[model samples]
Target: MTLFVDMDEVIADTYGAHIKRVNERYNMNLTKEACRGGEVWQQLPDHREAIWRHYFEPGFFRELDPIAGSQEVLRELSEKYEVYIASAAMQFPDSLKEKHEWLDEYFPFIHWSKRILCGDKHILRGDVLIDDRSHNLEHFVGRSLIFTSPHNVNTTAFERVNSWEEVCSKLL
Candidate 1:
């Protein structure tokens, strides 16, 4: 099967990184639970632009930690299926290079040829798409697996998996 996986939130800990950076920069103690059911910027309405600025900052994508168990599960899945990292990277100019470096450090098994750094997901053709955003999966003509994020906990539009372990149980 051709499995196209999203980078942010799904495999990369972008939510956690944003929270951590925002807390340190703004001197606010915001937990993941506090930002549940919405984006981090939504939680910090006053610092919305500041929070969004974090993504555009240098090394933002490079410094993100991997979602727990994602590496192992993805490596296993790569052995069984044709895996690809499909990320909306064009929005951020630095993300293209930083994401590539991040993947090399964490998921080196996923080669450059398999990485789909595109602006829109509608152009992708795959058997399955695993992403955190419902919009990305909206036009996807495949099995949509919604990888859980703090912001998307309340979403019920598609099949949801809270952890990489749950993903393994379903896909592997």
Candidate 2:
């Protein structure tokens, strides 16, 4: 089975970092607690790219933290499937590289042959696609693990889960 994984909010808390950076750089009173379900960008309309640039411009993915239990879950999943890092992060190439490097650092157990990077994850054609974006799920062709996003509630799905731990259970 080919398991397509998304970077950002699914494995790492990129959205959280974005929020913190926005508050720090723009002196906004926004909190990471408020940027949920598509509200992340809404909270910082003035300094959007500034926050993104802070993390992905020079490539900050190398220092990012995987979501709690993310490494363990991916490690286990890798044992049973072909794990592919298929992300739609082309809008930020440097950030994408950083994310891939972080995954390689944390989940080295996965073979290089199993890793697949792409801009549109729907093209990967995996048995399962795990992503936080609702539109991505609509584009995918198989079973999907729709990770919860504070900013995407307007989009709906039948298989949405609130956390990676819950996804681990459902997938296993």
Candidate 3:
């Protein structure tokens, strides 16, 4: 079975990266709990533009830390199922290239052919989709697993997995 995985908050800790960038830039300490139930940018209402700019900044995507256990879990899952890194990368100018490079450095096992960087995820056809954004999983025809993130802590419209370990218990 083909398993489609999202890059940003699902496999990569983009949510944490956003919060870290804003906190470091503004000289404030913002915790993940502070941004629960919504996007990190929402936590910094006065600095929304700064938070948004991070996505456009060069090296932002490349500098993000991977979600814990994603590399090992994905590498092992690849041995059992057809896995793909499906990210909506066209939202930012530098993201497409940076995301590709980031995946190469971090998840080299996911071949170039298995990477799908696009504007819309509605085109994806697979047996399972694991993503952080509820909107991305809304239209998926197959099983949708909402990978948990601080921003999506309140999401309850679909199946959810709080960690890669939870994913292993469910999918592996």
Best by TM-score: 1
Q: Per-residue lDDT for 51-143 in model 2, tens only?
A: 545655575666666777888888888888888877676776676667667767887776676666667766777688888877777788988
TM per candidate: 0.98, 0.86, 0.97
> Where is model 1 poorest over a 10-residue stretch in terms of lDDT?
43-52
The lDDT, on a scale of 0 to 1, for candidate 1 is 0.93
Error of 1 at 62 (Å): 0.1
Per residue, candidate 1 scores C-alpha lDDT tens digits across 1-172 of 9999999999999999999998898788999998889999997799888888898999999999999999999999999999999999999988899999999999999999999899889888889999999999889999999999988899899999999999999999
Local error of candidate 1 at residue 93 (angstroms): 0.8
How do all the candidates rank in terms of lDDT, highest first? 1, 3, 2
> Positional deviation of 15 in candidate 2, in angstroms?
0.5
> How much does candidate 1 score in TM-score?
0.98
What alpha-carbon RMSD in Å does predicted model 3 have with respect to the real structure?
A: 0.9
Rank list by TM-score = 1, 3, 2
